[model samples]
Structure formats: structure tokens, C-alpha cells
Target chain A: MISKEEAAQEAGWIERCQRGEQEAFAPLVERYRSAVFRVVYRVVRRRDEVEDIVQEVFIKAFTAIRSYNFQSSFQTWLSRIALNHCYDYLRRVRASHVTYFWQMSEEGQRNLEATAESREPGGLNAEQRAAVRELASQVLEAAPPADRVLLALKEIEGHSVEEIGEILDLKPSTVKVRLHRARKRLLKEVSSRARVRPGEPAGAPRP
Target chain B: MRCDHVLEILAEGDPRAREIKEHLAQCPACAARARAWRLAQAGFRELASEPVPEASVGFTPRLMRRLAESSRPAPAEQSFFEKVGRRFVYSTLMLALLALLALAVPRSGPLRSPNSAELMLMQPSVATLQDESVLNVDGLGSHWPHNSTVTAPAAGGQR
Candidate 1:
């Protein structure tokens, strides 16, 4: 949580930025670079692309600084911009047919398959751990762009529904409904591929 | 609890997690789904736990350099319809101005109204205008002798 003094100081920087002080923006970027990077990485799941996206998000926020009002906290406003950038990136990547785990190498495929069928995370080595994350990422990538971002924010980034509402500019109730629907669709996708049945244990079949 | 109700509670979380666990113990179908839900949740936790890559050294400096280079706002991309719509508006305004200019200017000089004789001449058919006598009356009335072959004005009118 940001204290009142820090908030006031950040507000000062924003005011300076709004007045065309380019130097004032560096501090804001320094403060939020990790945050923007983490969100972009979680949504897009490409290390090479995260830095470029983070830089672009900051440039956009700086360029459009005049539109920022004090109605919402600076962090929330910045997060909304970051998410919007990530969404656009995801859409373009989806269109290009890249980032689909099925297109990965034989080794990667094996890793994902083995990880998917495993019942527990214990006793997994580093590579297997990475595979677990990759399996989770594939499920998210298969979802629609809006739902993908929401799931990344809620499930992967550990944000609450209310926090998601602020970043997404949606009501908490709306977030819940959309989240519930997204989760259902993903579960159906996973289960149908795996052929999971009542008598059988889950994650037994490879998808 | 129904399978869906139990699953929803499992997936979305609830204060009655104990009840859900009890239901899962009693029901195989719900238990299968419960296993699935747990698996999915575990995957999510693994993803969440992955450490974010640290920004490389000189990230801030590189960004600041890029910012300086791109200080001017990039031109916004317009849709095809937007381009067409903008041109349409410009053309409409140009046409309106032209029409307003046309209305403002006074008509004069060669654009003056024709005399009654010209109006009468214009009213006749081409055949009537082709008549030599009619031409004589309008063109050579005074130059021609009275006794010449040229018909008199009254006779031409009669003709």
C-alpha cells in the first residue's frame, strides 16, 4: 500500500508531467516498470516481448498523461493502460497463429503431457515446473482475449475481483459473472479434450 | 449438493469448503470434477509462483532515449471509412462554398436578356427561320430595292 505522503509525491510528478515536463515521467516509469512487466509477461507469456511491451505502455501513458484525472489512483489508471496494451498484443499474436503450445517441439510436448497427467506438484524438477506453468499458459491462450486478460489478472497475478474491476473498468459483480463464465469454458475445454469421466480421476488422459 | 453446485463452489471458492469436501466424498461424479478443479487450480498456482524476469540493465535509460526520440505523438491510424468520411466532408464543404459563390455573383454583360425581336426569332421553327424572305426582312430590309425580288416586310409576315 502507498502511504499518503508517497501518493502526494506521485501526484506532484503527474502534475509536472501534465505540464510537459518530460523528466518527471522517469520516476513514474521507474516505479511501475516491474508492475507493467509482470502483467504483460503473465498475459503474453513471452519473455522477449515483455520488455518492448512495457516500454510501449509507459510511452503511451506518458503521451496521454493529460487525460489522466485524479478520480482513480495513478496505479489503477496505469494498470488499465498496461492491460489494454497486453490485450492488443494478445489479439495480434492470436491472429498470427503463433504461441500455440501444440506447435511446440517434441520435448516441450512431452513435458506438457507429463505435467498435465501428474496429480501433484511435489517432486517435480525445474524443467517440469516450467512445463506446469506452460500447460497453464496454454489453457489461458485458448480463451478469448478479454477472458484471457481477466484470468491472467485474477488467477496468475493474484488480483481480487474488486481490483480487477478497477483495472478493467468493470463492476465487481460483472467481473464475477465474466470470470465464472470464462472458468466454465476453460474447464469444459480441458475436460472434453481429456475425456474426463465420473469414475475416472481427472488429468489422467493427455490432451 | 448437485454436481454443478459443488463444482462451482470448488472452482469459485466458498465459505462452505467443508460441505463441498463432504459432498465430493459421497459422490464419484462430483469427486472427479473436484479433482479436475484442484488440478486446474494447482496449475494456476504454479504459473502465479513463477518469478517475473528482471528488467535488464539500462532499461530505464533505453526507455528514456526512446521517449526523447518519440517526443512527438505518432499519427493515429484511421479506418478506411474514416478516410472516406473525412474526404466526403471536405468535398461537401467545398461544393457548398462554390454554390454560395455562384449565388453571390451578379449576372451581367453578355448574359443580359435578349430583345423581343430575338425572342420572337427564337420562338419560330427552323424551317420558318430558313425562309429567305424572313431573312431579308430581318437582315436586308432597308438595303434591298422595293421593286426587287426581295419580299416586303408585310408580305414576309403574311408568308
Candidate 2:
């Protein structure tokens, strides 16, 4: 829960920044930089792009400081800017390369399918987990910006529906519905595209 | 095959991945569901780590430089009010200078010299005076019988 004192302090800083005190805004940036950076990196897995994206997010927030509404926490406002930048970057990449969400080489697809159909019937080990992460990096970017962002925030960032609604300007019910749809798309697409293994029962779970 | 249940499991991310796997073993539809969710969760976990990075020593300085730069306006850019004020000052000075030169410059033209000897020539001529009198040339009241064409009003007055 946000306290009244913290809110007042943030308001004071905002007022000062709006009044042209550049240094007064530093504390605010220092306070939220890590949180903002994390959100950017969660969606943008490229190490090279992540830092630039994070910098861009902060710069945008800085430029638009006067328009920030005090009703929402400063963090949420900053997050909206960060996620939008990530979407723009994702869109630009998609437009330039015509990358699809499920594009993978035959060997890559086989490895993903093999990982999904591991014979252990046990928990995913470290290597399997790493492979899954690698596959996610590709698929998440290839997926629709809205879907990947929703999934990243819900599953990866662990934001509640209410928080996401405020961040994305969506209703709570809408957030829930969109979140489900995004997960459904990822799960369904991955399952349908994964190749069947040799000598595996057609209807079985690759056991 | 309850898609709702599978969706809930994926969203919830609980009951231990192993327990979910055990349940998936008997349920074919859910097995596939679990497979997808398991892959998704692995990625989620991998990506979620270190949500924020530690700020580098140079980071805040770079940010300060940016903030400082942002507060400073571009060399070529100016506000609307500034442009209007500059233009207003320039226009006002130009008009004032024109008025001052108008007063300081000598009025030596023939029209400006009202007391000059050429003022007599500037007066109306006898012909113009006769034109003003239709039936009286120089007030003699001579209505000539041969001048029938001068019955209408003078067209020269219209010019």
C-alpha cells in the first residue's frame, strides 16, 4: 500500500521538477530505474538492446514529466512508457524482418519438441529450463506485442490484473480475458507445431 | 478436455510442477496442456530474474547530463511568445523610424510650398471657369443659339 507521506513527497518532487528543477527529478529516476529496467529486459531479451531501451524509457519519462498524473503511482506511469517503447521496438523489428511468432529451424523445432516430450516424467532440469528460456526469447518477440507483453507481465513480472489494468488502461475483466487468450495462443500454437516423436503413441503425451 | 482448468493451472503456477506432471500422466488432454505450461513457466522463471539491474556509476551521471540537456532549450528553437515579441519590436521600430524620418525630412516639393509664386498657376484657369458656367461665359449670360451641343451637363466634371 502506498502511504500518504510517500505520495506527498513524490508530489513535491514532481512540482519541483515541473518548476524547472532538473536535479529534483534525479531522486525519482534513481528510485525507479531498476524496476523500469527489469520490465524492459523482461520483454526485450537482447542484452545489446535492453540498455538502450531502458535509457530511452527513462528519457521519455523525463521529457513527459509535466503530464504525469498524481493519481497513479509514479512507477505505473513510468512502466506504461517503458512497455510502449518495447512494443515500438518489437514492431520495428517485426516490420523490418517479417519475423513470425513460431519461426524456428527443423532442428530447433525438434529440440523444443524433444524438451517438451522428455522421458523423465519428472521436473524440468537445468538444461531443459535453459532451452525453454531460449525458445521463449524467440517466441515472445515473434508473438503479437500485446500478447507477449500481457504474458510477460502476468507470468514473468507477476503483476496482478488490477495493476496491469492501470498500466495498460484496460479494465480488470478485459485484462483477465486478454491474459487468458494470450496464454492460450502460446500454448496452443506451441503444441500444434511441435513434431511427433518416432514410435510415440499418437494420442499419448509422448510417454 | 477442460481448457478452463488448464488455463487456471497455467495462470496459477502452483501445485508443484511435479504434481502437475503426475496428474498429466493419466490425463491425455491435460498432459499436452501441462507440457505447454511447463515450457512457458520455464521461460517465465528464466526471464523474471533480476527484474532490475544495479545502477552503474556512470548511469546517474549520464542521466544528469540528459536532464541538464533537456532543461536547456535547443540553440535554434524559440518559444512562440519570443518570436512574436521580437517581430513586434522590429515592426514597431521600423514604423517609428519611418514616422521620425517623415517629420525630419524637409517638405520642399511644389505641393508642400503653399506660399510659393507657382500658387497662382495652381489656381483654376478661365476655361475651367467657363466650363463651370453652362449658359454664362465669365458671367456674361451668353446663351449662344449656335451652341446646341452644349445642352447636356459637362462630362469633364465627371472625370
Candidate 3:
């Protein structure tokens, strides 16, 4: 949440931008660059492409700055543009069959299974957390682009359904349905891809 | 409850959360589904804990440069419809000018073919005037013969 003063300042910058002042846009970009980068990185999981996508998102926002009517926060508006750019990037990546650096190795797979099956009580250790991150990355790669983005937003980024709906221009109920389906699909992928010991099935319930 | 329904309830966090606990105890399949959901949730929690990447140094400068470049307009490349519309306007203007010329030409000068009577009246000679006594010259009496084609008529009197 932002204070009213900050919002007014941002509105001033946006108003200047709408009047064709390019310099006013710099402050807005500097303010939201990190947040947009984090979201793009979480969704795309591609460190190399995140910067480029973030730049495109800002340029798009500035280009369409006139359409903004202060209906939503500037961050939410920027987030919508970022997610749309990520979707396009994911589609292009899918079409080009590009390989990602986060593809889980054999050791990563083993660590992932061990971490999931571990019966430890409290917070996960660093190694277990790394394993889980690896598994999340793998799941993101295997899932379709839409599901990948939704899962990243809801699960990894910890955004609420209402926030996600605002970002994606979806109803809260629709966001709920989509989030449920994405989780189920990703779980199915993990079950099929992650291996189990001999005479035991994958994704077996905890004893 | 069916395993799928149980999973849906679990995923959605339905208010009837107690029902799922009972169903999990009764059905092994549902129990497995519930366990998988827990593991997945755990994985998500861990993933969420992972550090978020920050913008690198000079990111703003680089982005501003890119924005400056994007702000620069490209050389104008007209679309097919625009080209057609331009041509249409030019053609309409030309047609209007042609129509105006057509309307002004006959009013400015006598460009139409003259009839024989008008031709004879235009180039009258003294001999033709004498030969045709009934021919009126310079608006004189109809039956009188004029001596010369270029003769001047007395003011307010017959030539």
C-alpha cells in the first residue's frame, strides 16, 4: 500500500507523461522496475530475458499512459502490462523450443523427492529449500504458459486470488478455478516426472 | 467423498475443512490426494522463501535509453488504405477542377460550332450584303442594302 502523498506524486508524473514529457517517466520506471523485475523473473524463471521483458513493460505502460484513469494503483497497472509481456515471451519461447537453465538435473530430482518425502517438522533447511525451488522451476517449465504464470503468481509469489484477478483482469472466482486447475496439473506433472523407489509408486501419501 | 471432489475441496480451502479430515481417514485415495496437496504446499512455501532477484546496476539508465529510442518515431510508412485514400482525395480534386473548367469554358468564349446563318452573319462582305438585300447588318432596316461591311452607322440614325 502507498500513502496518499506518494500516490499524488505518481499521479503528477503520470500526468506529465501523458502530456508527452519523456523525463517524467524516468521516476516511475525507477520506482517500479524492481517490482516488475521480480514478477517477470518469478513467472518466466529466465534471468537472461527478465530485464528485456521489464523494459518492454515500462515502454508499453508509457505508450498507453493516456488511457490510465487512476482506477487502480500504478503498480497494478504496471503488473498487468508485465504479465501480458510475460505471456507473449512464454509463447515465443514455446514456439522456438528454447531450453531453460533451471531444468532440474538428476541430482536435483533426487533432492526434490527427498525433500518432498522428508517428515521433518519445522522449516526446511537450505538444501531442502533449494530442492523445492528446483522442483518449482521444473514444474513451471512443464506446465503450459498460462498455468505456469498463474502458479507462479499464486504459489511462489504468494499473491492472493483477488490481487491476481486484478492483475489478470479476471474475476476472483475465475482466478480460484484457474488456480485450482493449475495446481492439479502441476501436481500431476510432478507425480509423473519425479521418480520413486522400487515397489513404491510416485506421490504416495505420507505414512 | 470422491477423490477428485476431496482434492477440489482441499485445493479451494472450502469452509467444510472438517469433512476432508473425515474423508481422508476413510478413503486411502483421498488420503493420498490430501498428502500430495500438503507436499505441494510445502514445496510452494519453500519456493516462496527463495530470494527474489533485484535490478542490476544501471538498469534505470539502460531502460531510459531504450525508452528514448522507442520514443523516437520511425520513418513514416503509410498503409495501403491510407495511400488509397490519398489518391482518392487527389482524384476528387482533379475531377472538381475538370468540372469547373467544363462549366466555365462555354461561358467565357463561344466554343460551339456556329450554324450557317450565324457563320454568314459573322463574316459578311459588301457583295453578300448587296446580294441579300433582306439581310440585316448592324441592326439596320431588314430590307436595306448597306454600302460597306465596315461602314459606321450615324448615331441614333440608320447607316
**TM-score preference between candidates 2 and 3, better one:** 3
**Fraction of native Cα contacts reproduced by each candidate:** 0.43, 0.43, 0.36
| Per-residue alpha-carbon lDDT of candidate 3 for residues B51-123, written as tens digits (9 for 90 to 100) | 7678789988887888887787543564565688889999999999999999976544356322323543544
Once fitted onto the true fold, the runs of candidate 1 whose alpha carbons sit more than 4 angstroms away are A103-131, A192-195, A201-207, B25-29, B73-159
TM-score for each predicted model, relative to the true structure: 0.66, 0.63, 0.68
Candidate 3 — what's its lDDT?
0.72
What are the per-residue Cα lDDT tens digits for candidate 1 across B63-124?
A: 88898878844345546657888999999999999998776442321232223234444443
How do the residues A16-82 of candidate 2 rate in per-residue lDDT, one tens digit apiece?
9877677887888877888887888777766667767777787788788888877787888999999
Candidate 3, residue B25: Cα displacement in angstroms equals 3.1
Q: In model 3, what are the clashing residue pairs, if there are any?
A: none
lDDT of each: 0.73, 0.69, 0.72
Top-TM-score structure, candidate number: 3
Which portions of model 3 show Cα errors greater than 4 Å?
Answer: A100-111, A118-123, A195-207, B12-15, B74-159
Better of 1 and 2 by TM-score: 1
Model 1 per-residue lDDT at A179: 88
**Candidate 1 local accuracy as lDDT?**
0.73
Clashing pairs in 2: A38-B51
